[model samples]
Target: MASKLAHPLLHALRAGGPAFGAWLTLPGALSARTAAAASPHLAWLVVDCEHGMTALHPGAGESIAAVAALGPRAPSTIVRIPATGACADGSAGWQIKYALDQGARGVLVPMVSTGAQAKSVVAAARFPPQGVRGFGSPFTQHAWGADVTPGEYLAHANDAVLVLVQIETRDGVANLDEILAVDGLDGVFIGPYDLSLALGLPPPSPDPHPEAETVIQTILAKAHAAGKKWSVPLRLSFRSLPRPNPVTNCRDLLHRGTQAAKRAKEGFDMVNVTSDSGAMSDGIAR
Candidate 1:
């Protein structure tokens, strides 16, 4: 399938407003419920390709395929590529290129701690002199058709690919200025869990740690000041269902959303909800 070319991330950037999104770490790739969680109104989709163990060895092709299938069906597809030396072995670059060429709207490089690391991520996602990324479109480029040209492919590949960096360690936050200064960095995503480890503190509610939130707000403020977009992950557990099997989990989420809406109707304003999974769920109001 010659995937549609509009990048949701670009739209998000253009909107220049707070963007809410979710992370999928459950078994299997993006399930129907996971995909359903994505709202076009939301800015992006961070497919936790690295830390989220939905797949033992996350395959770039499969990840791209799954996300692409949701195009126009969901928000932008931002695959969180492994941010380790293992990916530095050319295989990771291939994965980045394949995902992009296969219609992934963007790539999120996780655990980035330095300017060089951020640049390396850019290199993996781009092609030629600009970066070292390889090229292939497969079905995504043409949306499964064969009309897409090399020129068009290269242009779309360059113009629309979103590059995100995850700042998870204290080192990354301390060196935030240099990392954000790196050209072509699309955004700085915060990983609260690892960040806590970096801060020598327990995980969320990362409250009571004004220092950590300060660092996060600093990153966010700097990113905004630098004219960069910011993306955050939200994790939600619905109350409708007590247990979180795939089926009940979704129902519970809907039930909770419904209740929240009902509360709003009753004149109580409830904008966000926090749940387990330790991942950030934006608690998107349906």
Candidate 2:
């Protein structure tokens, strides 16, 4: 039987190609549909609930449904949940449960600062025997975009779902080696803005301070050495491109295409192109 849980983004990462994607910050299915249909090349789409308008329950579910509606052609949907520290009474676990239940292909937890915290994120995302995720969501199959039985979904979810933790603080950088050592962690994502702040530099610098660059390089090298996938957000410029015009459309396409190529060349396993909010702002400005 065909593997019902196979994900294109997972395949891309395994094949060692950069999985390019866009961030969904808007809170609706229309926005998701538009973004997913914009490019067939997108390997995944991150439904940003942490900083975006997508709420945990209905909004996230709607967005996931919209994207997954594309079926095989849809970019894999991964949701970035709000911050959680360590185990913290399993609040993070509950969030993971809700996201997975709603049919997110993966979950990204932000602000993790230690190996213990990384382990907790993994436990919350995986099922028992490997971790502690419970399986009782009747609607999860819909989000998976496959016609698998519930038993099959449960059996394969542990390996199918991607579990990523953000390394964005001084403590997280200090414990990078230990965090990478945690089992069941699929990858680590760097929040360059917060990382800059943690490094005592200005937040959101176009050019990172030399010290912050060292930390970023260290995380990248260590993740590779541990055979784990690592990612960093790279926001591309949409300015100077007129919106709704063919000229602008060509420019946007070319710009994103170039950025995706550069990210692949840089050896990033996954890359988020830009956020929905950012796109909207850029359009309005244009």
Candidate 3:
């Protein structure tokens, strides 16, 4: 059934290839469209609403629309809403609702550290009977496609929309089993940067401490064991930190590509290859 959906990510996974994606942070319809059409290997694109310049309300919607405009070739849009880490609380409900309401194919909640927290995020992304998401967005069906009516979308959305949570804190890793047990959660996305910081280490400077790497592997194994997918963005976190040499940016992309391939072979379901700004930075530095 997932294969029948007009979702490129599903097609990519089915074809056993090009499961990687780019993260969008620049904020604009043009930026979103460019990233979506950037590569055929891109199976997904995350519209960063948390720390990115894109506003959660109008900006995320526009970006999702931009990707959807690509029709069949568009990578699936997954919005990372604001609220860095919701720990054991359910405070991210409204934010999840806003993103999903805007027609995002999925929602990635950051810093989820507990089973209860995971359940709440799932609830907010799903409709009642299974969860508590409201569905009155008239424009949402348009993003799905011209043939999809509101009724069809509402009927099939619960299955099509993915709800993934970022497991990047000590508590999240410790409670991994419980969080993975949450129903309606499609997968877990690992945030190497925050996970390192939460575990008493610096963010990955192209890679994590040996101990952090061990933990990441453990999480991946545990998620797969529980019959859930594991995902991750570029491992060279440090979005705000500077580099030793701008020239290293080119090598970094190569390193990232290598890492992404290794993980994908290791059973990682989704791996983000780069970002809008990351590519631009590498190009400018070269």
Candidate 4:
């Protein structure tokens, strides 16, 4: 019942319940569809353009549509644009445009270190008066399955499109207060492994270093105190994992069930299916 007016992710967030998400790193529509269908608990799916095999332009767009075709209750598709903090300016605007115009429910901007950068992301993802994002996608309105006319989609999109910034850098931690104060931001998604590395600690091995865990909790508290949603994952990355037997790889979600429960207990807004595409790949069972 999330995003009753539009996207399910928004609906889930508004419902004040912890939404589960699938981490999509692989490309192709079939893969996305499979993932969306794997778990009824899946409230959203993130098309990982940042580090995944999925390309931004056609790939992410196709994935968005693939999941949308599953109907209104199907998981909402969000795009994690592949760019670093350096492109906080208008350079990232076009990428944001592509993702939203393709009918994505949300956009996750990576490595946002300053409030100005977070504002830039928010502005780029929204329409005018609130943002500089342009309109004209005939397909976008259909993606939400409401049969909303262009006018309806345009009117609600500014509020419906969730904009989140990753707080993973040293400067991001230092400026967390300022970033949280920025208007138009929907939430903050913590990148724990990167946060560890940024803070001169090792990447989390299933869990963050003790010090990094402290920081993660601090971030959770800060996000809640600021009245913004906090999103994170059980595992930070799967890029380092070897290409193992597909069946073995697919059991990650089951393996992480305990951590998932722990995350839910900690008041995270949403937690990932697994650290990688493996959890949902090849129609893996939840």
lDDT of each: 0.58, 0.81, 0.83, 0.83
In angstroms, the error of model 2 at 161 is: 0.2
TM-scores for candidates 1 onward, in order: 0.72, 0.89, 0.93, 0.91
> Better model by TM-score, 1 or 2?
2
Poorest lDDT segment (10 consecutive residues) of candidate 3: 235-244
Cand. 4 Cα-lDDT: 0.83
Report clash pairs, candidate 4: 2-11, 2-12, 3-11
Question: Compared to the true structure, candidate 3 yields what TM-score?
Answer: 0.93
Which residue runs of candidate 4 sit more than 4 Å off their true CA positions? Answer: 1-5, 236-255, 280-286
Lowest summed lDDT across 10 adjacent residues in model 1 is found at: 267-276
Superposed by TM-score, candidate 1 places the C-alpha of residue 161 at a distance from the truth, in angstroms, of: 0.6
* lDDT digits (tens) for residues 9-38 of candidate 1: 465456543444545554444452355354
Q: Model 2: residues >4 Å from true position, as ranges?
A: 236-260
Clashes of 1: 14
Candidate 3 residue lDDT tens string, 1-286: 4233467775665565447888888989999999888887788988999867899999999998888888856888989988866534657888888888888889998988889889989888888789888889888878777677888888888988888999988989889999999988888998888899999997787788899999989988898888777887784442445763565776777888888888788878888888888887777777
Q: Answer with 1 or 4, whichever has the higher lDDT.
A: 4
Runs of candidate 1 with Cα error greater than 4 angstroms are: 1-4, 27-34, 37-40, 56-60, 70-73, 85-92, 143-150, 206-208, 235-286
Predicted model with the maximum TM-score:
3
Query: What's every prediction's RMSD, in angstroms?
Result: 7.0, 3.5, 2.1, 2.9
TM-score attained by model 4:
0.91
Count of steric clashes across candidates, in order: 14, 0, 0, 3
| Residue lDDT tens for model 2, 1-286 | 2356647788788777788888887889999988988887888889988988889888888998888887766888899997656653566888888888888889999999988888888988989999888888788886675687788888788888999999998899889899999999999998877789878886432345688778877888899999899897865444333345645645665676676577578788898877677676656645
